[model samples]
Target: MTTKRCTMPFLRACAALAGVALIAGCASAPEGAAPKNSNGWVKDEVSDSYVFAYPLVLMDVSREAATGNAPGQAASNTLRNAQSLPPVGASSPPEPNLDTLVSTGWLDLGNEPVLISLPDTHGRYMDARALDMWTNVLWSTATPANERVNGLKAQTIAFVPAGWKGTLPARVKRIDVSTRYAWFIARIQTRGGADLNAVRRLQRGLRVAPLAAWDAHGKRAAQAEAQSGAGLSGDPVETGAPAARVAALDANGYFNRLALALEDNAPVPDDQHALKILGDIGVHPGDGAQLPSGSKDMAMVNAGLADGRTRVATPPSNLLAGNGWLWIGDDAGNYGPDYSLRAYAAWASPGLPTSRDEVRARVAQDSDGHALNGANRYVIHFSAKQLPPVRGFWSITAYTTDGALDGDAPVRIAFGDRNGARRNRDGSIDVHVSAERARGGSNWVPAPKGDFRLVLRMYAPKPQATDGSWQPAAVERQ
Candidate 1:
């Protein structure tokens, strides 16, 4: 007989009954301790907790918002395709790539394993990634090098919970996830909107279903999970808009969410240190923050939350910085225990591809160190040899400081080989950046009216790109 796992709600109720007195006693640095030392410890705890929970909260909020009954909202456990590029000034995500049609969905792994089937791409550039509740990439088609050999072949992936005992088909690959919830993002390359039909055809070939809903013939079983309402149920938690959900979280709310997420998504062995820190501050897994109300400790917790937000927004020292560009090296998407780097990257560039599949360089200033303003034109001159080397392609996209596209331009704003970028007589390419169309023609990426940032994305980048041997030319003010 299978034992039933304790649910998050039940665990939370038990924690609440344990009371604040019990929590305070468990704190390593309790109130009335050394004022200076206590403050420092509290601050560190807040930062660590915030970084640890950023991805979890972000995923939860996004999943909730997307699964709502609204017109544009996508139901959970189903894939939603973006047919075209995001409109100008859209807040969905910054630096929207014009190269691919995006497909996104969330997975519910509470009942049984979910099977993801992919069709052979036949040399087409495409990747599907599965990120756990904490934002760690559990599985991706872009990794392990050999997976990309001979282009993408039709494959079956079964994502099961950790320690699950089941008999998977011999052909289907098994991926064990420690979390009950997972997010899916698939990017299929396209030359432009004209190539969208081909991408959509490939998109239709992708399928996701519960293990019970899968048949021995590798097809979906009819009327299996449908009657049980197993895979299609929406999340019980009511969540607001993604940004709003994040903004509305207070110290208590944030820790409570973190605690709840931990109940189901057990941390890896590497996270023991972080978990210990959180527990000392009364934010144990499955239990809410138990700090006493109107206490000095409570006040300190609030201050730490604010500071943690700032740190996540600021770039850490390890980010590769040169020529006015900032980027994570080969460790872009798969951050192990580097919570600070992971949190910061997620804040700056959400849904980043793994470094093997793509590396992004972002700059807000020109070569001379002045902020890039659309009113002042600039040029990114790539000499014949300086062009980004990639097995797939590269593009330079512009975004506002807040990570939104320039509102003035209706057309997709980017310049690259796939677009109509022109080469100079000397085999160099000059990409013009400005609000006004450049006289250079065909190589112009329209910037916003004010200060903006530029992202240089090298898809399927060559080894040199990530090996510290190749870097793009500096952006020069005109």
Candidate 2:
């Protein structure tokens, strides 16, 4: 909660960015005299502003990569489904989900409400969530608090824009979004390679259309659209890791993109304070402002940008940390004015669901606080009473330190309830994690040949899982 202060030189630089010679602060302070906290305040404010604008900028760039100048691109409001899982060692979207097939799209909600229709999976596990441009969860099928259910029945949802007066069909549910754009993501459980066809069938049943094109029953009235295979097209756009791309932007490029994004995705009520800070730095809703280019000015802004990146990459104070694991559950997916938490979540993994939907924990160190490596064998023993509490399922997957699936492993492996892990006679489950196989090979998770990390996913987690009453055991070195 560091505060921002205005200084004479910074104001002059801001005025320069706005293409104005002098602003209100010019007469207040004498030229060539630094204010009481000029350097410190500017650094703090610049870093804070960068964190505030991180999610919006990242989302805009990802959307551009998804829908612009790509071969076989799917337009906005069209679903592009993944027919299979990401390839081994794939790292584009860091920490890729290995337990489900994903179908995603961008929605243009400016003109009219977009319709998303999903088919019944007959009790199979599936969930869909829509996030506004700020990365807030607008609606999620996994949240029972919202009266939504996952894949139990055929459901039709309409994503309507704010302040739009419209009457959707009687059976269609409506979700109002504050931004002109939204991202929709849906996932269905997959057992393994054998479960691809069934998941694909369900994926094909997922549909998206504009409200104007839908009939009374939520089906598109246009015959041609219905026959277009539900907007399934070529492979999904690969934008290499978005976090890396965002980190590479200089102050000019970063602030310019933030200004452009703010035009479509207006700030929320709590965001006004941060917006005011940004305004002091010459960044406005629609102005692509530039930073001063003098040696000292450039050095100051670059230092601020570097600090912001470090802050976003650091784990927040409220994270759940135990047994060498760090994970966030509370205030996730619906962050309000917690810009640091929100920005870090977006940097770690965009489109994170709320705690009720899922809770993910990651541990990169052993019980002794040593970095996990394949050279040392390890085992995770879960007592019967301490097993992950979840209504849907749970899984633990290994990845390289950089967050990619281990391609060099002998086989693709994950262990959890869905994978049929073996239990000891004493009612405990021991999962062997190593490059070499453990005895019997029934509950072995293939580790990378080098340093690695483990992610534990608890889908539809129970209350104890997030309330600190239950936690996964520490990984013990053998």
Number of the top-ranking candidate, with TM-score as the measure:
2
Clash total of candidate 1:
0
Query: Which digits, one per residue and each the tens of the lDDT, describe model 1 over residues 1-478?
Result: 1112223354334333322211232235356534544455576567657876787777777776676457666556667676666666764555566667777777888888888888898878787788887677778886665455346899889989888898876689889988898887887777765676787678777777888878876676665332111222112122224645686788888888778878887777866766766876788877777743547766777877888788777886556666788776666676665666677777776666677777888899998889999889898888999888887778888888877777777566568887787898999998888888889467988888899999898877787676566677888988
Clashing pairs in 1: none
Q: Which one is best on lDDT? A: 2
lDDT score at residue 339, model 2, on the 0-100 scale = 72
Task: Find the 10 residues in a row with the least total lDDT in model 2.
Answer: 17-26
Q: Where is model 1 more than 4 Å wrong at Cα?
A: 1-40, 144-151, 222-244, 292-294
Candidate 2 lDDT, 1-478, residue by residue in tens:
1112224345334323321111113234335434635554455556778888888888888787776435645678887787776677777577777788778888998799998888888768887888888899988876563233244578899999999897897788889998999988888888767788898888878888888888876776664243122333222544445667899998888998899889989888746667766876678888977555567667777887899999889886556677888777556786665677778888887788887778889999999999999998999989989888888888998999888888787776667888888899988999899988887878888888899999999888887776656678889999
lDDT of 1: 0.72
In terms of lDDT, the poorest run of 10 residues in model 1 is 227-236
- The C-alpha TM-scores of every prediction are 0.85, 0.88
